[model samples]
Target: MNSALEILTKYWKHDAFRKPQEAIIASVLEGKDTFALMPTGGGKSICFQVPGMMKEGICLVISPLIALMRDQVQNLQNKGIKAIALTGGIHSDEIIDLLDNCQFGNYKFLYLSPERLQNDWILERIKNLPVNLIAIDEAHCVSQWGHDFRPAYLKIVQLKEYFPKVPFLALTASATPRVKEDIMVQLKLDNPQIFTKSFYRDNIAYMVFETEDKLHLLQQILQKNPQPSIIYVTNRKSCNETVHQLESLGFTATFYHGGLSSKDKEKHMQLWMNEKVQVMVATNAFGMGIDKANVKTIIHLHLPQNLENYYQESGRAGRNGDKAFAVLLNNPSDILHAEAQFISVLPDKKFLNLVFTKLCNYFQIAYGEGIDEQFSFNLNHFCTKYSFPTLKTYNALQFLDRQGIITLSQEFSEKITLQFIIPSKEVIRYMSLNPNDEEILLTMLRTYPGIYDMQTAFNLQLIAKKSNHTENEVLSLLQKLKEKNIIEMMAKSNDATITLNEIREDERTINRVSKYLEAQNKLKTEQLQAVLQYSKDTKSCKNKVLMQYFGESLAADCGICSYCISKNRKKQNPETVSDKIVELLKIQDFNSRDIQKLTKLPKDDVIFALQKLLEDETISINSNNLYSLK
Candidate 1:
């Protein structure tokens, strides 16, 4: 095996490793558990990928997103390195075949979702493979204190016993001290070598604005900034509304959400990535594993549920290390809205049991009979039938999912699968009629073995390239083959999947995880309050506050955040503040808060400057308490 440096240059085409990359890679290679806290674009992947190449056996990469797994696999294959992603929706037979290949075929990397680790069959198959390293991406999910806690991540602990000698590498972009310790405990990492990069991005300037008319302010922001921006909303409906308004203002804007079809999501994403669109309006569902470097701005119309999410999302800006802006637009009512829509909607013990009973009845699952069973879920139809409020009911389902009672997977896309139904003789006969189809089918066979055995996720784009045919031509040939009964083709379909872990439980079985759920709700409320404080506070530098939140005591102000800029301007130039206030008041009588917005000054300075003007008799207050220059 080549050294890490050799492999880095040979494969990734990089001459150097970023800050702690070399040390982290070295630690993993020395057969030690490692935990790396890197920022979003901190090249965490290289810390593992380079080491994986220097090892003798396959590296098991655990990830959270199916799209991310597919992307990494495709990129490796494009670079002539064989890789595979064990995504959902694949039939069991195909899974077995793929695992069999992993065991017998000399493959280097296997990208898997944390949820997939809970399967006994999957665990069994993974035990048989010559696994050299275990890399858990998004490792913060293992911590109950983290914002995105996935109960499935707990199953990763079971791997240590199976691969006792293999080193584990856990990576996350952000985690507080409590969450950090929780991740270490939950993963059972043995004295792991920890590498933590600072959460500071000097290139990004954090700015927050409180306004009544967010749309008008958003327009002004879009008009002043560069292209290729992302506007994140809190809901799918807002995604459409924002995009429509932006487009109405004569901008090339598009919207994306989980509600959109797979094709539309891909279309809109590509349009933004290719610079065909100037802006993308989306829910939080967007911007995971996205590698756009030139995004000049990211404007959040609402506060994220937590600072971890806020930091991760804002880090998307200025990835190229260029000057960029992260702007938050907030309204006074957003706090009340967050409380009602998020914390208050959490289902209590009573609601949890009811939702469980209703869910079992909704699925018609017999008591103690539906264990390990899967079903396609239509929540809207179920809610309508049972007269359940969608918001509260959905929150209950999420609580159940987090408690490990069952697994609920939504927010997925369509995948194409092809299988051979008839004998090879029929396929040959059809190929005889069409020689070009013969070449394409042969190319698929050469590319992916056992396509005749079961349905598999065939790459249409890759197949077109290999067969020297356009994608339309490839689809046409597949349709031709399906029409002639040469192969069975499954068109892309997108929906949610729910798998019952045990029989639907009443109070007894449900109570086992009840305390955990209650703790989760309380933690969520705390997280919400934390973000609200960050958004509302104007006295401190936003970066310093963020760094302190993560337990770093770095006292230096970023010096350029909106808060610091306002603070410096106000303290240094009190005269300018008074002048701006007087100038604005001369136009029309206004309150102190409104004057702050007009002057873009700090609240304290606005108040102080207003007092100075009144004492100097330069401005007078009316009976309504609106101020004006006299």
Candidate 2:
């Protein structure tokens, strides 16, 4: 058998194991239950992969993130290692074949979701495999206290009954102290060897700036740094808008969001990864399994839902150990906006019951049935039919998904393909004859520049909005054009797929997870409050604050954070700040905000300097409220 180090070098091409990885791998190899709490970018995968390679049989790895699972499987395959992931959207026959291969094909690893374990046939097949180690990625999901708790993770402990002697390795990048305890309890690890790496990244300078004009500040920061960076926004609309803003300012940037097609997502990701674009403006969906080491900056234009998300996102920078920055741009209005978007949309028990009942009724699922039944789901149509609030209904469905009640698949959603069958001149003539279709046709032409040449998958919602018509109206018009032979159109009207994982019991089903629902809602609220407090903080060291939150203590302040830098600036001679303000006034009229930006001083110090300059008669306030030299 190859040794752990030999396997690592042979497969991963890394000569040395990072600190603590060797020790954790050794524990797993010794047949002991292991728990690893490493920060993001800490190479947690190596702990399991190396040990799994050294063992004789295939390793069973379970993860909640389908994308991450696919990514790791692809990476391992690219390295000539045998690996397979049984994710969603796979045929049952193929799954059986994959499982059989795991049994007889000399496969080294099998990756699957925790939810897959609920199937008795899958469990029986897994029980028959010669599994050497059971690796659980994102192990924090097993804990109810975790930020992303999945009820399916509770079933993971049943694997121990199947493989009693197999050592289990559980790993996560973020888990609070309570969550850590919950993970060990829920996974039922026996005498688990625990390894925790400090969350502090000395190379990352955490920065928080309060500004009303975020775009202006963003421009300044990007211009000054000009390195490969990521700008995080809250939604798809903002992602595109920010990219446009950056491009207009002569910066190369691309955007990524959940709404993008898989092809577009890969295209944009490659553009940023190859440095064809200097920046990637994206939502939180962009960073999983991404290992770009030289990202110099991670800037958040909107407040994250919680500090865990912020830490995970910001930690993406400076993975190469050089100096980097994690910047958060906040304003007073952001607090209210975040609360509205995150907290207010949380569905309670009653709401969940309502959503579940309506969903079953909509699908025509009889009571105490509907297990394993799948249906194409049109969220907008359902919400419109029932007059349900769209956001809350979506949240309720997500809650059902997390609770293992239903499987919601958003893959390949919102796809509308169209191609002009007639010549462009004939299409224009048809459009002119049909005045009502003229606007929508023109909008489609402008939005998809290549529609005349080839079949194109376009965003129906975007076309509806751009054409100033309802989506139904746009679809109707497109259908008319298609019937007239003006164009060929195929619209996948369903935006998601819903699979019933359990029988429809309506209130009884919701009552089963009521306590968990309440607890999770409370936890989310507290997490948001903590994020708000962190953003409003001005005195504490940013690194120390983050470390303490994750159950680590720092004796000394990190001198690179925004707080430390401001503290050092305050110790400078007061005359220097006053001199800078005076020089700016001599050049032109200025306000306190303008002076603060130009002089790179804090607002308080800028105000103080301006007051002193005015008292000394070296500067005077003009009628326009701008300070000028007297």
Residue-level lDDT tens digits of model 1 in 1-630: 687888889888988888999999999999999999998888888887888878888999998777678878988988888788987555577789888888888888999877678778889899999998999999988988887787789999999999999999999999999989999999999999999999988888999888777887888889999568999888888998888898899889888887676567889999999999999998877887787999999999987888888888889999888989999999999888878777888888888888898888878987777776766676777788888888788888877775556767775434568998888787778778888678788898888788889887777767998889887798898888788787788865445567776675577777887777877888989999898899899898988888889878655889878887777773638898887887787689997657877888766678888899999999999998799888
Using all chains and alpha carbons, the TM-scores for the candidates as numbered come to 0.82, 0.84
lDDT of 1: 0.84
Error of 2 at 79 (Å): 2.6
- Return the lDDT, model 2, position 194: 97
Q: Could you give candidate 2's per-residue lDDT for residues 471-499 as a string of tens digits? A: 77987888888888888887675657788
lDDT of 2 at 617: 92
**Pairs with backbone N, CA or C atoms under 3 Å apart (clashes), candidate 1:** none
| Error at 449, model 1, angstroms | 22
Worst 10 residues of 2 by lDDT: 407-416
Candidate 2 yields a Cα-based lDDT of 0.89
Cα displacement (Å) at residue 247, model 1? 1.6
